[model samples]
Target chain A: MNAAAAYLTSFLRASYRDAVAGWNRFWFAPTDPATLAMIRILAGAMLLYTHLVWTIDLEAFFGPHSWVSPTANATFHEVPKISEIMEQDPYRGRSFVWSLFDVAKTSQQIWAVHIVALVTFALLTVGLWTRVVAVLAWIFAVSYVQRAQGALFGLDQINTMLAMYLMVGPSGACYSLDAWLARRKNPRRGAASPSTSANIAIRLMQLHMCVIYMFAGIGKFVGASWWNGTGLWGGVANLEYQSLDATWLAYWPHLSAFLSHLTVYWEVFYCVLIWPRALRPWMLLIAVPLHLGIAFFMGMITFGLIMLVGNLAFVSPESVRATVSWLFRRTRPAPTTGG
Target chain B: METSSRPKADDRHQACCPWPNELRIVVSLLLALHVSAIYVGPFSMGAMGVTSPLALTLRRTYRPYLEAISTQYQGYQFFNEPGPSHLIRYELEFADGREMVTGKLPDIDEHWPRLRYHRHFMLTETAYTLVSRTAPPTPPPGLEVGTPAYESWRQFRDADAALSRAFLKSYAEHLMSVHGASLVRLYGIERRYPTPEEVVDGIRPGDKRFVSEELLDTFTIDIEVVSP
Candidate 1:
């Protein structure tokens, strides 16, 4: 009995040690800031572009006289929209505070607030006081979403999450003006060092992204249309997104079903399959093309691109560094022969 | 570059990402709040198994702050329907008594640089986001269809209908005024068009078979708003 108890204790100790070691490696291992920095620039550009698009019909959508007035927009959060009697989201409630709607009443006020938002996004892209700018960028993103909750799509949601996550990381660490300034002062600051904040930020994005896919997949599974294997066909054929009439897909019904089922399966399994070392490459192969197809076929190119870029958080910083170095070497002019 | 007395790799690793333990705890807490507030709603908890009272408390506590963020996560419940029900059609009657009908609108079928106005479609869809609550007001106690109790339900529904009519009148007025019309007529279609299961079997778009001639709701925009 003594021998058995001693063995059990020894086994428990070893298991605990192993688990602690694994936890530390997963969470605290030093990660290059370059990956987070890259996401910052891309997501920042997306931010500016997303807000700039609002300028197209700014008055028409955000103006008080527009179809959905400010009061209606506010009520959108609280009650089911009368027009949309079929689709009701019980989870949402009326937002109590609105930074954008409360402050800007007229077009000029809206434009003024918009211009300042654009400037904030521009500064964040260049990494000036990134810590401060990141927070402001998130606020700007939230304000737009709140003011025009009716005008939101998947891309808008993705942009908000990316901006939120960017604020959490040391995203301005490398490939940024902050890095250049730091290097100038220290002279020995490595361009590709790890930042704990960056790692934490990336991890949050990673986990959040997994959750997103899992839900997206599960939502698809629950819908009767997806099970019938006609969801993709409906999306493609919808007149609202009829850029290139993919009605030809109707002719190939089996092919359409295959694509639909593939999407559902891919999304549901993404959270599980993406974690394995061997399966990651496979996941990327399926994911990258899927979003690209969404961009080309759905005419939501920006939204698709943003979703694809968000997936890059799963990539190791080492791989990101190597890709950057390769691009630089290829673009660099052939070394000039000494005259 | 320093050639002598250079720090070893271990020293460099320690310095590279020296994130203090305290900050990690703080950020982790914030992330938890964020996740709870945004994703742990009544509808979304099916996958995460977040039914506990503690989770409910955390969601209620942080939900206000989360809702304030721009990153609204209603989830992409798109293309999950058997078919779209709302088909908005516009009609205009000129002072001369000539009438015109159009299915195309600036934000729906024809918007410049198509991508820009996709949000218009999304906005319309947002108006119809699926809330699991009952779509119709239940009949009053001891009330059956065609009875006075049924009329009470009808009144409740009409109240909602009036509100919707006002919102659409503002938009339809904008559309009709552009077409030089004096009177505005709008139609809201409630359709359960054939599902993917019904039509995916070699059905073509030119067939014009999916759209049924069933008129669900036909209401005139009786209110007057700005023409432009």
Candidate 2:
């Protein structure tokens, strides 16, 4: 009895130690900011474009008499009163969401706020004072989403998620105007040093992405079509969602079923498989086609592209740096040696 | 494209859990709390009507933080069901005896750049989602009134009715203002997708047979538009 107890205690001790070590290594280890910087440029560009598109009908959608009226918008953001909470109302009240648009009542005010938002997004994209703009970008992104609650989908969610995480790290450490300006000021600075904050931000994004896919996959099980392998057909045959006329997929039922099954399985397992170095690439590769397919075939180009940008969190800084350097080298003219 | 090259000596030294132990512990706790919150959002919104009680509790606890950060609605349930899409069809009547003008919430021709069209598409879809929740489940025959079950259903019905009214009325007033009309009629249209068998049988996806419409509401200019 004494020997068995001792062995059990030893095993538990080793397990706890290993778990703590792994957790610390995963979240706190310093790393290059390259991946975060790349994501900033891409996600910031997406944020800029997304807000720019709002310019076409800014007054109609966000003006005083907008699609979602002020009263209804207020109702959407209402939180449960203290009395209701104390009474244990089963149906929790709406959330207490904040938005800058809440204060911008007039068309002129809305346009002024919007132009500032656009400029902020552009600055974030160019990596100009990214530390400040990244936070503002998130605030603006969330404001737009909260104000126009009815006109949102996955695109806005992913876009805001990327922007939010970008604020947690030094997203403009490299490949940014900030970096160029820094170099011009002091030519002695080496490559951006590894950063613990960068690692934390990337890890958070990677974990958030895993959560998204897990839910997305699990949610499909609720539908009857997803079960009998007819799910892909449902999306493909939907006239409203089709961008490229993929009804041709009707002729290939078997292939359609294969893809539908593959999608669910990939999403469900991504959280697990993505952690292993060997499996991470395969997971990311699968994400490319899956997102691109949605972009081209489903008419949600922005949503699909933003999701791919979120997946870039799984990519290593070294890989991003190497790939970018290779592309630049291929594009630039070769140096001529003195004859 | 991943490389397995060894880190530089300095990078390796710095990578060894560089944060002080106290900071590491603090962040670890926060990280655990955050990840749990993230998991709880969708876990409470479980698939196949299977929400766990634990998930619901966690969701309630984290609701404020999640909302403040605008991460509460990240269900990520993309194409989960892929059911019928929705649109709002409207007709306007002017006071001067002008011919009635008709339009749709998301006329692709008018709403250029697919994103704009998608935004309008989401408007109708959001209306449908909100209105659908207003329908309470039918009570069993001979079920007693004032019981817990009946009270729950009654409360849900009342709450949902108020919510849907606010949403539909706002939309109605917007249409009236846009058309400069005295009266506006709105209809919710649901367009179901064609099945594979239907497609094989030469039926197109956009056939009128698959479309159904219901009158959502009607509004006059006298309906009070709330000031911002």
Candidate 3:
């Protein structure tokens, strides 16, 4: 048993080292300017959206007593019964833990955290104080996730992983206001670090995304509802909550069951096989349709599209360009790099 | 002559672009895909136009509490319900000392009448059940009754199921008239009630059946209208 445990520990340590080294070589190698530029722009855009979306109110997303600010006091709607965890028999013993949140609920504490998180996310997007802002965003996001584990959706999970990845280096490497200003002040210092910094960040993000997908697929496998094809059925059944028409799905009685079975299989099989080069494209292809179906049938557009973006990591740069060129005839001029 | 010029230009471009042409093509494609995603992708994602009044209104209503809770809690709830709508939703308190409710409410627009009718009807039915269960055997002798007292129910003939049913319906209708047509409707309450026997059967002795037993306790009535 000790030998087995030691083997597992050693294996994990080796994988971590390999991951960091591989990421450095691939993502921040200073060879693929386009890849680097793409990463910067994409990450920036997502961060910008995260901030801009919050220009309204942040409390709407979570309850008054968030993990980030449990002492917050305010009267809002009851926190939703997100999981069977609360309803589970064993969990009854720990019911007091849940009720404690109600007694200490405060909107102020939540608001304070929101202010910092939003500002940090915005700064990170603009690449201002890049590393510091990245760490701050990660900290804030983790705090939020812990407050209501059940309330967490896919987008929050993805962003939390993103915060961790961005910690490795200055994501403000290109196309940032930070980069433009740096160029004017000192042109020689405009380039990204030749060290493995970006690679570390990008690799973590990629691995983090893989874990998310694998976990999601695993969750689906454990669910009888997903296997029965009614996993997506519950949303469509509630007409008041539905943003789109999904009554047709229920009409075909057998289809729901079939879909549930297929969904579970896809999730489980993809989780285990996604890393293989031979199967990666196929897995992504399947996921794209599945995600798209989710967007259309369940009104989960944001999450479905975000997952699609994550799957883009599996796509080779060559294929992505080919696909883009085929769709749009306009060719982008190459950037001029000094000899 | 054109072919000759094309080769020279191609050679010059090849010399300039050390990165594979394929790489440039792929980058452009990826950018286009991303840009397209921001456009006609799915749902109403990229369709938010600044000038659209509907969008603006939605933004105004939605924006007030978007930052109130952490993004960790993204779920729905009623505008004002007894409990939170979902596990993830949080309440927001503005600096001005007012509570802010966020998330979507059940769509009542399509079933407005049904919902309205049911709301007050259920309350009335519940009131009747409580009265039937807890009403004393008799009012105190020589006591003066108020306008809202249950005395009006005394005029009806007893020991007749039909008479009792009619009496209950009439009483409900009278309440509706007084409450205003907008406030009370018959469709809101189910006409059926559990018979005394059904209530008694539900009681398991030794269990907490005292509430049901108290409800089943017999009573006698003697009401008179002395004035007019």
Q: lDDT of each structure?
A: 0.67, 0.85, 0.43
Please report the candidate that would top TM-score against the real structure. Answer: 2
Instruction: Report, to 2 decimal places, the DockQ of model 2.
Output: 0.51
Q: What is the TM-score of each candidate against the true structure?
A: 0.78, 0.93, 0.45
Candidate 1, residue A276: how far the Cα is off, in Å: 1.3
Error of 1 at B58 (Å): 6.7
DockQ of each: 0.27, 0.51, 0.02
**Worst lDDT window (10 residues) for model 3 chain A?**
A75-84
Best by DockQ: 2
- For each candidate in turn, give its C-alpha RMSD to the true structure in angstroms: 6.5, 4.8, 21.1
Worst 10 residues of 3 chain B by lDDT: B76-85
Off by over 4 Å in 3: A1-55, A58-116, A146-151, A183-195, A251-259, A316-339, B1-228
Candidate 1 wrongly placed segments (more than 4 Å)? A1-24, A80-97, A181-188, A333-339, B1-17, B36-62, B70-73, B85-87, B92-103, B106-110, B128-134, B137-184, B189-203, B206-209, B212-228
Residue-level lDDT tens digits of model 3 in A1-339: 999999999999999967745533344343222233345445545655644454342443344322112222121112211121112222221211222234324666556666767777777766677667767766666555444332334555555555655675556665466778888899788455433354445444555455455444544543355644555555454332244665565556577667656656666566467778888878887888787876665555555666666665556545644665665655666677999
User: Of the pair 1 and 2, which is ahead by TM-score?
Assistant: 2
